[model samples]
Target: MAPTHSDHHHHNDGKKPPPKLLTLPTILTIGRVAAVPLLVATFYVDSWWGPNATTVIFLAAAITDWLDGYLARKMKQGTAFGAFLDPVADKLMVAATLVLLCTKPFEAGVFGQAPWLLTVPAITIIGREITMSAVREWAASQDGKLSEAIAVNNLGKWKTATQMTALTILLATRDGSLIGEGTLLASGVVLLYISAWLSAWSLVVYMRKIWKVLLM
Candidate 1:
């Protein structure tokens, strides 16, 4: 039997109440955003113990990025506010990781290459985000339709998963004393490049769709 829109909403309503801006997922997302500072602290603290502590905290924060989304969906508590906070949380997390991962006492040991190379992935991700955001805003302005920023893409998911995994592994080697440091760093480098490539391709795919709408 085909489900009517009313039937869908009816079922959904019984499962959960409407999400408020101050709901669990929104709070979790904000927590993730706030973790960026602690991530940065690890790089600049100039103490062996501090970096390790910071790394652990950063990993916990990154894990929450996934947790909040899963909880929001499972609980049928995805609010408009959650939608806004999630991406902002993600961007800040990635940006913080890149900055910290490329800094002294960690970059060479964990990156397997010059710290500067990390910038390639950073720029790629940031560029796509900025471009796609502008395209969506432009479309909304022209059409008077309030499409809350562009929806997430599959490639974006892949990029995030790979990036977080790479960062996690890289951070786990914080003391520059972990076994397979070279192998881990090499893997991280590969993941970073792959992520960058995907980011660029995803941008093209998103832009193409937006262009069609604009041309029409």
Candidate 2:
């Protein structure tokens, strides 16, 4: 016997609904955010593995930062919630790590000679994140055009890459026994400064894009 259209429709209704929130990509993003506390806890371990553990945790979180975005696109699971949460997680992680590095006392390392070296870039990077976050929120409140105008650019990507590399190196070398302790610490500081410059440059570009819209 041939099934009627009504019968087919009834059958389809029993199927599971598509996932909105809590998808794989979204879970990965949440995992990255959850890692923040674990990373912080590593600092309190008071053992040889403290720095190494933090470095590993941070590296894993950084990798997921890239992976989640790729999966979101490839799996066609991109969502507004994921988009909003992703950047928040990244900023939180970076800001927290920078603050920890700046505050933690070290007997001998790049910051040992002059703490301001790390403090300056840390402030610049964190300040840029805060300012840009506010700018993004304001743009979203305005017409859609403003938001589009200030979309992420190449400079922003480079800044993130360099910043992550710098933080990872700094974390691993905090104990001063990772690899060529002196050279690595110096290289990390240099990279951090570069990332700070890139952050400022990207912020300027974003502001310029929305300046006209803001006036109107």
CA lDDT, every model vs. true structure? 0.74, 0.89
* Candidate 2 structure quality by residue, lDDT tens digits, 83-110: 8999999998999899999887455454
Residue pairs in collision within model 1:
none
Best by TM-score: 2
Model 1 worst lDDT run, 10 consecutive residues = 143-152
Q: Each candidate's TM vs. the true structure?
A: 0.79, 0.89
- Which 10 consecutive residues of model 2 have the lowest summed lDDT? 104-113
Off by over 4 Å in 2: 1-12, 105-112, 214-216
**Alpha-carbon error at 58 in model 2, in Å?**
0.2
lDDT of 1 by residue, 16-99 (tens): 654467878889988888888877776577677776777687788777878888999999888898988888888887777776
Local lDDT at 94 for model 2 = 95
